[model samples]
Every structure is written in structure tokens, then in C-alpha cells.
Target chain A: MPLIVKPTPAHPEPPAHKIMPAFATRFGPKLAGEVAATDRLVRVNALTALCDALSDPEQAHGCADAGVVETLNAHVSGGQDAPTRVLAAKALCGCARDARAARAMVDAATPAAIQGACLNDAEQDVRMHCYDALIRLGGGPRRGASSIVAAGYPKALVEKAEKESVGLQPRALDLLTSCLGNEQGLAEALDAGGIATCLSLLGSMEAAVRAAAGRCLAGLCFDMSAKDAAVEADAVDTLCALLEDPDLGARRAACAALVSVTTTDEGKRRMVPAEPRPRDAVAAIIALLAEPDAYLTTTACKLVANVAVHPKVRAQLREDKECLPAIDALIAGPGTDQDALVAQHARIAKDAVLWEP
Target chain B: MANSAYTHTTSPKPLLSKMKKTTYRAEDEENIITNNIMFDRRVVRGNTYAAQVVTHNTQREVERMRYESERTLRRDATCQRKERLAKPSTPPPAEGRAHIKAQTDTFLEELSDRPVESEAVTQTEAILDRPPSPLFIPSKTGVDKETDIPGGDLFDFDIEVKPILEVLVGKTLRVSMMEVMEEAELDAIQRRQMEFEQMRNAELVEVQRLDAEASRRFAEKQRRFTQETDRLRQQAELGQKVAARAFARSYLANLSELAFDQLEDSGHFVDPVEKEIQDSFIPWLFDSVVETTNNHISSSSCVDALIVDAIELASNLQSDVIKQIKQKERARVFAVEDAQEIKEAEGTAK
Candidate 1:
């Protein structure tokens, strides 16, 4: 017998918006009808079809308008078999891409349902789908984020990110980033060793995962303790190393994370190494000032301003040829030519770089 | 006529002296001059034309004439009635003096009956007017100049609206780009979720297959266990049977040989004569022969011993008999001789 290699499944192109009405009208009633079937196979089939249809945002929006989120919420909180529940959770996750559907899902207590299923179910696939759905559905609003925190989702996400497949790590990290939207979720994630997990994943071989981890670290560093922990873990050096990464996303995320890190005084001091180094963090941030992306340039300026508080970094800025010019150009740039926030932070960086202290 | 002319007002005083003093109280005056009699200024009489066109002086003259005529008639009637009383109680002292005294006294009485009055006679200065207020002089300090600038020169609408337009354009572009990015993100997440669903489905199938395989293996193990148990039990039973059979055969072999040997050794298979002799005749013949031999030998021994003893006794007896015979013969011979000698010896012995 020869080896049989399975081809990667091709993603379907979504139908045009004109057809969504008809698609929704056809699938909506069918889903509602079969979702309540006495036979498990019928319910599972219905859920699979719903999951497939929910992949298109237009279709998802139509389904939400047709009240499919409520039906899925029932299965999430029901005593259905793992496969059926998995399909329901997957469908809910896809539906969440539509903002209205996400809102509808949250209003339907889908987060609480997915949290329950994710926690209580013994099956890995079921738990994973529930996790995915919660990631898409839970941290949207303050109420849902609080509920997710109360359900201990951050700890579970951290654990899954730590132990699950590489494909799932970035998603879990992104969910953790969302969890950091609120203080309670941030505190919960921190208590669940989120800093360590994010810092460790910063060394991931996959650039996407590294970028996601960097983003999560950036979010986590909003807390004072997380900043201290990051500094203590030598994450400053690690992120500085990541500043040279080939992937722009990883670099941007690292830059954002470094910005968060530099908010604290210790992080500021850490930005300027005591010894001579090959790659200077301050110079790297100054170099980022010339990038065309306003967000990157803005974030880089913010990081520079934060670290320029240190006299050593200020001296380094004075020694560097391009730092002041770039910052001056940003400050002198016309309002129409540059982002307001970028110009504002560039002015702040200039002031800090030129300060005597 | 001369007396009348000389009668100065004493007569009028007499006519009034008889009259009762009817001083109107404030209340009575209000009652007598009721609102019906007192015309309201706002009331329009039926002859509106006459009321409206009537001059103030004419209306006053009419009112005065109507009251004056009534008063004159009432005064004349009272005067006529009091004419008798008009004569003084005493004749007038002198006409002129009486008239003078009467007029003076009437004037004093009238003065005494009048209400308290204050008369203010203001003598305004004739045409004493304040000098006309000095005419305000129109004075102008600064020159009034006006200049007209065209609306275009003041501001160009296009230029003025440029910054606003740029802001609007920038805001619109930013919002649209953000929307596009959001849409792409949603599409990406949707695609990822779909792929996850597929992977999850495959994993589900694989898990189910593994579960089925596990159950099948468990059933196979149970069947094998039962077969092994049955084989062990049969082996034990067969071993037990073999050991029992071998032990029984070994035990019965010695028993059968012992039985046959004992039967043959007990002499039940001997010949009839040998069997009879051995059983009864042998013992009988031996006992009889032994007894006869014993009897014969005893008799013969007894006879032989008796013969030898008799022979010896006979010899002794023969010898003794011989001696006795000889002695007897000798005694007889000797008796004859001894008779003679015995007679002698008997005689000697006696």
C-alpha cells in the first residue's frame, strides 16, 4: 500500500452579498429546524452546515439577523455530544467575525456557555473549539471580559498556549491580548503566569507566533507588576534582540512591547545598557522614526520619549546623527502630512532628547 | 310800599327763622342723591346726540337754571308763609339803623356758619421762562470713510475650505482603510476558523476510530482469557484422571495376584485320592498303625523280661529245691541217726 498524502483543504470563496439573502433564508430555517432534531446525526449535520455557512461575514451577518446565534448558544450550553458541540462552537466563532453577530453572541450569553463547555468537557477538540469561540466572543465588552475573567479563561488560555499545538499558540496569545483589555482580566492573566508565557513565546521559531506573543506582552506590560516582571525576566534584552527580526510584524510588536516596557523607570534604565552593545535599543527606536507607517512611527516616538528620560539615552540621542533630525522633521511636518499623535510624540521625544537631565 | 322798601332783610330772616334747620348728614346726602339721580359720566343718555353735542357751559347753565327755578319758587312760598312771622317782635328801631344792623349780623352769621377754608393765591411770574437749552453743537472729530472690498478679495472659498477639505478627506480615507483592514481581519479569522473546523472533524473521526479499535481489542482479550481458562481446567481434569487410573491399576494388580496365589496354595486344586488322603485317610492310617506297633512292642518286651527273670528265679529255686531235697533226705537219714542222737541231744537240750 502506498502512502496517501491528504491535500490541504481549499478555503471557499464567499458568495456575493446579493446571494446572502437567499442563502440565509434557505439555511436559517433549516438550521433552526434540524438543530432541534431528535437524532444526533441530524443535529451534527445541521451544525456542520451552519459552521460552513458562517465562514462568510455577509452570511454571518444575515444569520445573526435571522437569529442563528441564539440557536448556537443552546448547543453550547446543551448536553450534546462532543462533535456536535464542537461544530456549534466553531460556527459561533466564525459568526463572531461579524461585529453584529459577535454582539448578538455576547448578548445570548454565548461566552458563559462556551466557558462552561470549555471547562467542563473532557474532550480536547471540544475544549479547543470552545476556547476558540470564547476568544472570538468573550473579551469584546467589559461585561463579557469580566465574565471571562470570572470563569478563569485567562488561566486556561495561558495553559493552552503553553501546551497546545503551534497553530493554536498565536490565537491563544491573541485572546490573552484581548483579555488584557480590562484590569481584572489583566490581573488574572498575570496571576496565571502570562508574563512568562508571553516572554517565552517571544523566542518562538514562528514569526507570527512571536509577533502575537510580543503583542500580548505589550498588553500585559500595562500593569506595573508585569513591567517589573518583564524587566526581571530580562525581557528587555530579549525584545531588543527581537528588534532586528526579519518580520516586520514581529519588529512592530516588539517595538510596541518595548514602548510598554519603557513606561516604567526601571524599564527606562534597562533600555540603556551599562556596557557597550552591538545593537542599541535607543538607536533602533530612533531609526524607526523614519518609517512611513504613522502607527509605527508614533509608537517608536513614544518609546523614544519614554526612554529619553534617561540621561544616557539622551546622550546617545545627541551623539546619533539622525535621531534629532528625524524627530525635528516629524515635529515640523505639516499637520496634513503627518499623524497628529505622531507629531505630538515626536515633539515630546525632541524635548526629552534635548533636556539637560 | 314805603314800609316794604324800608323793610331791609329782617323780613327774610323772620321767614327763615320759622323754618326747621334741615342740615344734610353725609349719609342722608348720599341717600337723597342716590346713584339713580347722580348721572354717571360713562352713562350715555337716550339723546346721545344732545349729550354729545351739548357744550359744557350750556349743560351747566341748564342744570343751574333747573335748580335755581325750583329754589326760587320754594323760597317764595316760605317767604309768603313766614310773612306774618317776618314782622319783628318789636317794631324796627329805625329803618336805616335796623337795616344796617341786620345786614351786619347776617354777614357775621354767614361767616360763622362757613367751613374752614385755605386760600392759595399763586402769583406766577409773567413769562419767566428758563433760557432755552443751549443748542447742541454738531461737532465731528474724525473723518467718516468707507471702503468696499469684494467678497473674493476678503476670502477665497476654495482656499479657505482646503484645510477642512483635507481633514475631511484624511478622516474619510482613514475610516475607509480601517474598515477595509477590519474586513480583511474578519475574513482571515473566518477562514482560520473554517480550517479549524475541518481539522477538528478529522480529529473527531480519528478519535472515534481509535475508540472502536480499543473496544475490539478488549473483546478479543476477553475471549482469549476465557479460552485459556477452559484449556487450564481441561488440562487439570485430564491430569487428575490419568493419575487416578494409574493408581487404581497399580493397586488392583497386587490384589488379583494375591487372590490367585491364595486360592491355589489352600489345596483346593489337588487330585481326589491325594486330596482324600491328605484330608482324612492319612491321619487315620497313621494313628492306627502307631497304636498297633506300640501295643505289639510293649507286649513282646514284657514277655522277654518276664522270661529272663523267671529263668533266673527257676535256677535259684532249682538250686534251693535241690538243697532242700538233699537236706530232707539227709535229715531223714540223720533223723534216724539223730533220733538216737537227738533223743540224746534233746534230752540234753531240754
Candidate 2:
């Protein structure tokens, strides 16, 4: 008897549907299965699938479920692969747009892992995504508590950042600084030994790191205790040093931070340097008025103008003839006339002399 | 000498001789006396007296010569003063000539620095004299004559009329003829005509309302039918999910399938489920998802999308929708005509 070979039926392909899954479906069992699977390729594919699904509004609704939450939590708890964990963190961030998803994310133990990924991830994009996610997570519950002991997870992250080398330090420091924007988080960072870290970062070789540190210090100084902490850490001196940074942007950020710190009476007093005002922040800004870049000059002039208005500051500036010439040079420089900021400074200087008794 | 001469006597001469001698002698004595005086003076004065007289005469001559020399000196002084007074009063012809020379030199210097070519200078001078020709030519007079009568000229045919006859015997004539008709009768006729017009307007209004009602009903039915078809298609595509959810799934499935198929075809396959989704579900699900996500995203991002969609939709729909409305209005006119015919037949039957 001849062996008969069975012919396979030609299955017609399904019609192409261009619809995206809703949020709930994006985080549904199908995506969860992909997330839980041990196969690397499959896991990557599933992450991609979830990303695609979340890209659609309807599909994003489907993914706003416990499945996405549980999978993300599992990855944060056990996963060691940085890329996969980064993707998972991103998906959670996507889901976090919904209150339920945000709550679920907050309940999950993934914040620490996310913070770690933000610190250690080689890809800048991934790190940025992680920071974005953490920011969206309400920066966690212990945000504005007075002491680090009161701030459990954030405190640990700060400690870890404090122990890390300078190379690995900026990311953690950035995350901490980002958290400093929040009331509770800022308070916690200040209490959890964030002042020294931020001050050290202010001296960082990277201009962006210095800028971030200055920005964080500005936030910390907004509160009384944090302001005192900053004063003790010599934040004024550090920020004043950053005013001389080769990067104009860093200098602008430093000047902005100094302006914020000195705007208050207590902050102004605390920010005054010991020993001949070693980092005369006002003087530093006045010096920056000579910078060739129009933007930098404008920013510096604005800062100077702000400082020149205070009666005491005005008196101090009047005593320094060097400051007048620098300001004059800034006013006379190319493109300065077009800048409203430079013009404002010019007016302030005029008022300082003309209006004063 | 005189006493001696008186004592002596002399011999007498002849009488004629004595007489002649006396006369001649007297005349000689007289001449002698005058010459004697003249000569005596000339002798007494001698050369010295004559020299004195000549010296006096020479002195008078020298005085006259000195006076004339003084007069000539005065006249020369007066002429010099007059010349000095007249020097600066007017420029001399030589000075004017010098000025012209200086001007010519200056002009030559300027020309040397920037020489005007002879041809170009002549051309500019020529152009300055004549006005440029106009760009267009005038048409011939007869070619543009008025072809039709103007509105102003048409009024020439208008006229006013007046009645000549005042009264009539049997029938009232002209003006009185009009007064013969009663106002009540005209009023009644006008009232009846008005009522007829009102009735016709009411009928037309009824027909329009019915047509509108029919069109509205038809539109509602069409909308329902379209919606049903869409719902059925969505159900078929999404299986059993709710409409929104199914739309979402179908969209995601379609996008996934497209991406997967592209990947597979490119031999960069990452997943196979991406190829299993459908296409029709893409846009609907995408739009729904985007709308849902609008609340989730930043307000600025949502506003950006909304603005873009609004501009695009407004531009696309403006003319098309206007055309559709115009077409519907034309159809309504035809429906009104049909209703009018039906009404006329009903009126005849009644």
C-alpha cells in the first residue's frame, strides 16, 4: 500500500485591522503573559507590543489593570536585566496617567529599582525615561518629611547616591535634585544628607550636573530648615563658583538659584559669605555682564538688576566702581540694546543712582 | 657965468635966417627935451636900471609859470583821488575776466576727475528737452462710439396726462366717472384678493413644512442605517468587546499587524501577533484612543492636536457642506412645485 501524504489547507490571512488596543488591553493578560515569559526575545517582543498598545489611547485604557501593575512590580522585585526593567518602568509610567495606575505604581516596590536604573542605565534615554516616571509617581509617599529617617525609600536612595563614585554619582544626584522640586521630597533630601551631595555636584565637571545641583539647592533653600542646611553646606559659595562656569547655561542657572536664595531676608543673610564675601554672588553676576554671548550677558544683567534694586545691595554696588563700568560695557555691547533684559538692568542702574538719597 | 653975459653986447644976424633958425631950433629943442628925458632916464638907470626893469618882468613871468605849475599839480591830485574813489565802486572788466577764467579752470578740473563723454552728455541734454512718448496708442474715434441708448436718454419718452372733460350727462365723464364708483365696492374686492393670497400662502407653507418633515425623517433614517453598519462592522472586527474597547483592540491589533508584517517582510521579525490584526479598525480605534488619551496627556499637547484637527476639518468641510446645502435647497424647490400641482388638483375636485 502506497503511503498517502496529506495536503495542508491554505489558511486565508485575517483582514488587517489598524486599531490600537485600549489602555486596559495594553496592560491586560496578553501583555502580562509576554512580560512574565522567560524567553528573552519574547519578553522584548512583549515589551514592544505593550509599548505599541499603550501608544493608542483605547489600548492604553485596557492596559490600566492589575496585570500591568503586577508584572511591573514583579520586574522591579526580581528582574536584573536593565533594559527590560527600563521598558517595564516606562510602561508603568504610561499607565500612571490614570489615577488607578498611578496608585498601583506607587504601591509597587518598583521605585527603588527605577531609581537604581536611573543611576546605572547606560542609555541616557532610558535614564531620562526613568526620571520622568519617578516624577510622575508623585515622587513616592515620604516626599516632604523633615528627616531621612522619616523618608524610607528616598533616604536609602540618597544614601546610595552619597556612597557612589563621581562617575556614577551624577545620575543619582540628578534624581535626588529632581525630587527636591517636591515639598516633601525636598525636605527629605535636605535631611537625608542631600546638601553635601548637591554641593559636591555643584563642583562637578559636567555643567549640566552643576546646573542641576544649583537648581536643587534653590528648591531646598525655599524652606527654612533646608535653607539653613544649604547655608551650613556653603551652598552660596558653591553656587557663586558655578557663576564662573565656562558653560553660560550653568552660570545662568547658578545666578538664577542665587537670586531665588537671596530673595528672602533670611536667605539673603545666610547667603552672605564670610571672609570678604569670597563668592560675591552679585559681583559674580556683574562680572558675567561682560560675557560675549548676548543671552548670558542678558541673564547676568537681569540678575544684577534684581540685586541692584535692594537698598542695601544698591549701596554695596555703588561702593564698587568696577561694577558700574562692567554694567556700562554690557549696556553698550552689541545686541545689548535689543535685549529688554539688558535695558531693564540699565534702567535699574539708573534708578539706583538717580533714585537713591 | 650969467652976470658976465649980461654986461657984454654981440653982433646981430639976418632976420629970415634968425626966424628960420628959431623955428627949427624950437622944434629941435622940443624933440631934444623928450629924447633927453628918455635917454637921460635910460642913461641914469643905465644897464642896472634896465636890468632892474627886466628882472621885475622876469619875476612876473616866473610867478606866472609857478602858478600854472601849482594849478597842474592840483588837477593831477584831484584826478588821482577820483580814481581811488572809483576803484572799489565797481569790479573792473579784467577782474570779471579773471573770475571767468577761474570758473573755467574749476570746471576743467572736475571734468578731469570725472569726464562726461561727449556722446552721453549730448544724449542727456536731448532727453531733458523732450517728453517721453505715452505707452499706449489712442483708439480711432468711430471705433468706440456708444452702441446702445443710455438710461438717461430713455426718460425722454415719459409724459403726464390731464383730463379735459369735467362732467357727464348720462355717464360720468373722466374725473367724475371715477367718482361714480363707490369706495366700499373697491375695498371689498381688495379684501377678497388679499384673502385669496393668504390662503395660497398658507397652502404653500403647509407643503414646505411637510417636505421639511420628510427630509428630516429621511436624514434620520440614513444616519441610523450608517451607524448600524458601523456598529456591525466594529462587532465583527472586535469579536465580543464593547464598542469602545473593540475599537481600541482593533486599532492596536491593526497597527501591531502592520508593524509585524513589515518586520517579517523585511526579515526583521520581532513578533508574529503584530501581523494578525486588521486595518479598518486602525483609524477608529486610533481616533478613540487619541481622544481618551487627550485627558491623560498635558493640556498643551491636546490643544495642539485639537487646533490642527479643527483647521483641517474646517477647511475640508466648508465648501463641500455648502454645496450639499445648496443642492438640498434646489431639491426643496422642485418638491414645492410638485406639492403645488397636487394642491391645484385637490382644489378642482373640491
lDDT of each: 0.70, 0.56
> Taking the tens digit of each residue's C-alpha lDDT, what string does model 2 give over B1-350?
45541222333221222323434324443332222333332123333322323333344557666876797679779988998998775456774365343454534543255664433121223533554444344443211123344345332323211121222333445434454353355456544653343233323323333454467568879999999999999878776566768788778878878888888778696444444333445666888789878766767677768877876776556455445444544554767776555456446534
TM-score between candidate 1 and the true structure: 0.44
CA shift of A308, model 1, Å = 1.0
Per-residue lDDT over A1-357 for candidate 1, one digit per residue giving the tens place of the 0 to 100 score: 212233334557653221222354565665556665657777777677667667666666667877778777777778777777788778877776567788777677676666666655666676667667666665444466666666677887787687766766777787777677667888888999999999889999999899989888887877768888999998899998888788877887888788777666688788777775688777677778898766668767767766776787888888899998998888776776446657877886787688772
Model 1 chain B worst lDDT window (10 residues): B10-19
Provide fnat values for all models in the order shown: 0.00, 0.00
- TM-score attained by model 2: 0.39
Model 2 lDDT at residue B47:
35
Model 2, range A1-357, lDDT digits (tens) per residue? 211222333555532231223343334656666667777666756676776555445555555553576676556435447667767767765665445555555555456535545555565556556555554454333432222223344565567665555554554555565465456676666677776766776777777677666655555555656656666666667777788888865775676566555443444455344566656666776677677655456545545544554566667777777777876765564553456546555555555433453
Scanning candidate 2 chain A in windows of ten residues, the lowest lDDT window is A142-151
